[model samples]
Target: MHAALNAAQRTLVREIATLGTESGVGLYIVGGFVRDLLLGGAVREVDLVVEGDAIGFTQTVFSRLGGRVTPHRRFGTAKWRLPRELATACGWTVLDFVMARSESYARPAALPVVKRAAIRDDLLRRDFTINTLAICLDAERAGVTLDFCGGAADLQQRLINVLHPRSFEDDPTRMLRAVRFAERLGCELAPATLQLIEPARAHVAALSGDRLRHELQLVFEEKHSANVLTRLNGFSLLAAIHPALANTADAWLADKLIAAEAAGAAAEVCWLLWLYRLPAAESRLVAQRLRLPVRLTAALQQAQQLGAQRNLGRKLASSEIVSVLAGVQDWALAALVIAAQDEQVRTNLQRYRNDLRYIKPLVTGHVLRARGLAAGPQYAKVLARLRDAWLDGEIHDAAGELALLDRLLLQR
Candidate 1:
């Protein structure tokens, strides 16, 4: 298992082990890093737990390796970002360091109060059994695997099992994580763990909007995001985050997702499609509840409007099509095209995407101004006319554009 790590990861492990030996501090690679390592998956991030001062240990490692270390004194945690060139070479970005700590939630759906504890206690405090596995980086036990919570057995059984019954009550976000991990790892939620999902659903609302948004983003990041959404809906958890999705049907979303995947659409574009059927007011309400950024909300609004007008694209002239889709993003347009039902709408959208959208008159605003055409509201009208002529295939070259301009000037 130790040999599975890449050269960069192995180097990091050796250096941490040496630091532990010199400083007499216990160190181990823990959490997701260990789990992914055991699964023979790519390790893009490293999580480390130190039995002694985590910040001091991080500083020592940084001093030796020449990197920036950011410490959070209050949390007994620190993060080290490798220098850019080295990080590029290593295929990893950051290393997280935390003191071995146990947490106790003050109340249901509240943040935990943390305190330094033994490695065993730390392992027990984790969300899922699979994530509790750890690998020691200290010299004497350099490659020892620690599984105080039957994580290895659970991993072999392909089950996601919580460490305790009250786990979700303490941090409801774990419910979302359970679904994410179950879908991501192609595992099933243990029956006992599945039983708590309903009770945990009620507390998901207590989580802050930012945290909920983050979890939702993680779901969208997955390749099977549509399936994850279906699972969340089945768990009666989707509405707790926002009512818009709860009231709507997900069949169209599933179909659109398949098309979007084939089209190579981005996650944000897929999310916009999911919300495209809602009215602007309802979309705004959902966005506000989820704390979505202003730009994303606006994009959703535009996509909704465009998606509603998809049928009109086929009947409209080329210039009209350009006017309608002038500033819309390609992803948004592609998503709308996928959702469009009419073949002509699809054909027109394809045309716009491939050719018409890029058509513009060879004439420039500078040339128009040089012709003594005042730069004002009328300039836009004239330019629009010129561009429309080009898109309509009526103007083929600069001479044709100049002739059109002369006619417009004569008419003026």
Candidate 2:
């Protein structure tokens, strides 16, 4: 346990213990911290749970630290956002405090009801066994782990096992949580836990778009994103989340996605590439269902259009390559350049990247204005023609640019 925490974290634990001891309430470092420690995973965030009046405890602690505390009396919860970062050689720590409480989910999609509960009860009510482990912060039990749910054994086996079968039914988001844990930890779900997913698959549709979006984003961002998606698809859960994706993403695309995932590619990039094989309408619908951000949605659209044009073969004119490069972000365009299987297409993209002519504007609005052209939207047309000529190698440098500008200015 000493090896699990760094010197700075040890200081935090000791300080927190002093406060809990003074108040006569037990404080424990619970949930993810313990699980990650036992699994030999790096702990980036720690959750401290106190089995007492959370609001008062939070206020007292905040006052001691000279920080503000906000209490939610109805929920029996409190939160303190540290004004300053805890200085640590490893990294500055940002701490938050929460009270131990039992939660009751009304419906799969509805919010949970919160009530103060014993620390053990708090641990027991969590979604999974591995996340339910806790360690006492009080002097007597300091560092002593509390594992009423057999989380330590599960961690030893590198398995994901939920606390109960109703875990998913209570909160459909846990289905995605299971996938994230499996992907992030490189672990597999226990057999019984895996069996519980399908029955609750339909309940996932009941989740709000916002909730589903957050969970799905985590799925793609995980190290095993491609594998997680494949597992979800195999279980028939993908359709419930995004019916359009399941409809259009065939076996070939799935294989591509799996390979990309294994290669340690970014999830967003892999997703965009996979969506390229889909029909435009289906892809748009899937993006909508997944609530993807506007930038990513645009990237996917551009990649699809580019993929379509790639079928036209290696003789892509300089204009087409320039247009493609201009529409995409540098990273995505670079990835597309590397992923291009056709020699001609790859060469054209590389040429656009390396050649000066592809980037130099043929004409500018200032040039148009200089030729007695009115400074309005029509100047845009003049610049576009000149730029097109330059990209097509009709213009070589400033002299050619001036010649083209002269020609456009002579017309309307």
Q: Which candidate tops lDDT?
A: 1
- Candidate 1 clash pair list: none
lDDT of 2 by residue, 209-309 (tens): 77887887777676656567777777777788877667434565556666666656676777676566668898888788778788888888777677668
Cα lDDT, all candidates: 0.84, 0.74
Model 2 TM-score is: 0.79
| Model 1 C-alpha lDDT per residue in residues 74-168, reported as the tens digit of each score | 77999999888778777778888999999999887887888998899889999999999988878788789999999988888889999999999
Predicted structure with the largest TM-score when compared to the true one: 1
Worst 10 residues of 1 by lDDT: 307-316
Those runs of model 1 whose alpha carbons end farther than 4 Å from true positions after fitting are 247-249, 310-313, 369-374, 402-412
